[model samples]
Target: MTMQLAIEVDRADDPRLQAYTSIREKDLTSGHGARFIIEGKVTLETALRRGRFKLGSLFLAKSRLEPLADLLAQVPQDVPIYVAPQDVMDAVAGFPMHRGVLACGIKGDIPSPAEFLSQGIRAAAPSTLLMLSDLSNHDNVGACFRNAAAFGADAVLMDAQCCDPLYRKAIRVSSGASLWLPYAHGGTGMDMVNAAKAEGYEVWAMTPRAGARMLGTLRIPEKLAILLGAEGPGLPDALISAARPVRIPMSSGFDSVNVATAGAITLAHVFGQRT
Candidate 1:
């Protein structure tokens, strides 16, 4: 196999790998707007191959290189690839990284949530969209991304309060679909609902509170956009009042479902209807 351009670094303090240092899940938000860290071999490989994000650098454990030879070969020679021992890797990240794979990436000209939703509106064909608000959990957002990709949602629209899908844990939990799927962020819950409505979309707010149209018999719209709020106290009253509220059928006594699981079921139902 062709060799990859990988540089071996001796210490965690190496200046060349500044981007990959001190990596903790919560503290990594500083890179959300521009750069992100890709963990695990699959996530790193997918991020590089998709070209959705600019790969700034790579850090690898000595043991992982041979297994990841093919993916490594695909990385740009100009991009600095650093290999270090797992001890230093754990120290830099503040935890043991059993997978021994990590890469740093910077986002490019991806559109904002409102902008992407607008494009879907202008398109000739019907579009499937998922929107989220105040979803602060990375795992939930990651699972949502995976579900969207699996169900072929065109794009994900999230509000300013939603967790970053590119967060390392989210990216990993998503099995790397977080890098594969196209997503954008902006606005408030009400603002997003209004945007969807103005663009000729029938915004379906997923909620369990009173006044929700049961999702079972609800007709999926030709131009559909699903809006979801964070777990617990889902879509606010004003947003619900502005959009058509829908609820998944469950036995009596349940207040709600996991946001990601609900999204998956709803996306599948919408896909079946639209198709």
Candidate 2:
């Protein structure tokens, strides 16, 4: 690693460190900015390996320097690395800063959801898509990404009402899966369903409503999109009505599972069929 490429900062309010401040508040309103923070060593490493998102800079505690030396060597020379003492790091981040590693990623030239889907589908023959609707919880959104990746889904499509999958906690909760997963967010759930159908995908909206077909009974399609919604409210009736409704079998008293868990079960089933 080029040790000199790292800059040592002692001030919490340093202008260069502005992006790492008030993380919680910023995560909520950040939108799809050109820059976003990636926390922890694993997420940073995943971001580096994926190379889909450009890395702007790295912020690390001095203690983390020696441990991450090998990984840091892979960073582009143009990107600056900022090192600070743990106390100063905590002060700057307005939190414990326990992970001791952070990176600013650049979301350059984001494509429209349709474009993303088309490109991903072309790259994978038996494509699978994980779709989310009105999922406000960051944990659930992140878990969904992790499940999608684990099950070999080609990409994810999120409705405009869903929370940002790139949010810091979401990234962490996903165990860095969000760093590599190709996903598009915005537009209504119906828009995504229609787009997938147009692309020759058989859309399956997961629901526990009465009369929905059992997931095990259906055959996996060459191109499939599994739509999952937030818990409690679940998917909108109109949206569910628009696609093939599928449900996981539950005991007599239970009808549904956590949205992410439900996604995992459905995606796993799809993966099993492919194998």
Candidate 3:
């Protein structure tokens, strides 16, 4: 029999539940070491299956326990599962407990571009990848991860300024795609372009600048890395110059779409053709 012993905490002040306490009031950069809070059923499921995170504990609303028992059984017995009543959940988290699913886990290292390229995405068949720059919003980053998974992108690379895809809200928004995707973070946008090039990937930078090739007409190579920037300003001139510029078609007077939407469209175009 699988021993799924769930501990019940009656008080909000319990030190064992420190990871779930007053999250809105705390800053992620201050005391958080490698551990991050995971939210929702889908996200926790992916995180558990991926085994990338070292889980600390699971804080679930008492009512949600039965629904999540199958998933809970997959969890190692060494990890504690905490079940709390609705009132206790709300009191501990300082918010209403709706989904009633939550987890605390440790984040592992994200490899750098050179190290990642050493694994040979270039050697693979008709590959696809997304290189993101300065994507400050966690939700957007998460959505891009979802798109990458949907379109079968081999990997995702985020510039130094892009937000962490593992942010609690990002994990929820991604429906756990962020947990499953292989991602690397480091360097500037140009650094990513060059790394992709070094791996023999045909680097294409997506932008709306003058003289850029239309998205529908461009020829995607065997190993392609598409670069996307945050909305509004788009890719920097230096980064844009580092790779071949490509642009998506749009109606007159409408020049932009949300970064995630644009990436998905672009990814769909390339992936759809390959398959």
Candidate 4:
């Protein structure tokens, strides 16, 4: 792809930079429509490389242009690259904007849960799937994605109660994994589990409740869905009853683990089983 000319913005309030204004505030607001902000060079590079959405624009600190030259050269000619001095960049972001690399992406279309489950169906072996329910914390959600991707999960599925994985902090926390990992978000927790079952996946509901099966005892299924829930209440009893309840055996004093940590351990086990 031909590299686009980098536009220099001397003023922080340049109209061309409207999408980037008050960025930290916008990250918390639900007014973005189809737009989402990507922070730092690593996440931006992921978007440019494998992200499903089309990049609307890139806002960079002047000093970042040279260091990111190799990666920036791959930008599509239609995407504008805006370069501003450090002070101006910080003024627009409403914070320090320390990473100095930011970009806007237009979320065009997301696959439905059924559509996501259909992936890799014809292959000899099914890919692992990670499902989340009511995980409101962005950091936990991001860490779950990072763990899922690290363990080679094919996709992530989140119920309606889960926070948006595209949220700026979540994406950054995922180390850009959210940018490339295929995910479907919507419907109730049971809806996700039911869909996976229809696709021939054995659903494993992760919980630490009494009588739950130990993670080590079961053989990994060719098509498996590992379901995780919020930290405090854990999965709803009704949802847990709908799937096989499984738990990571902990010490005598502890009955639970952080949702994200549980996910990593579970996924890592399934990964080990496969190898």
Give candidate 4's TM-score: 0.95
What order do you get sorting by TM-score, best first? Answer: 2, 4, 3, 1
Candidates in descending lDDT order: 4, 2, 3, 1
Clashing pairs in 4: none
Per lDDT, the best of the predicted structures is: 4
Estimate the TM-score of every prediction: 0.92, 0.95, 0.93, 0.95
CA shift at 166, candidate 3, in angstroms? Answer: 0.3
lDDT of 1 by residue, 1-275 (tens): 47666788878877887777777853554656577888887787788777477788888887888888888888887777888888988877778989898888886666666676666533555778889889999899989988888887877888889877888888888888878677877778777778778888899889886668889787667778898888887888888888888989888888688999999999999887767
Candidate 3 achieves a global lDDT of 0.84
**Candidate 2's residue-wise lDDT over 1-275, tens digit each?**
46546899999999999888877678767664777789998899898787478888899999999889889988888889999999999998888988999898887665546666666554657889999999999999999999999999988888878887888889989988888878888888888888888888898989998799998999889999999988889988888988999989999988978999999999999999999
lDDT by residue (tens digit), candidate 4, 1-275: 43578999999889999889997788787546688899988898899888878899999999999888889999998899999999999999899988899999897666667666765433657579999999999999999999998998988999888888888999999998988888998888888899999988999999998799999999889899999989999999998999999999989989988999999999999998897
Off by over 4 Å in 4: 1-3, 118-124
Predictions in order: lDDT = 0.81, 0.87, 0.84, 0.89
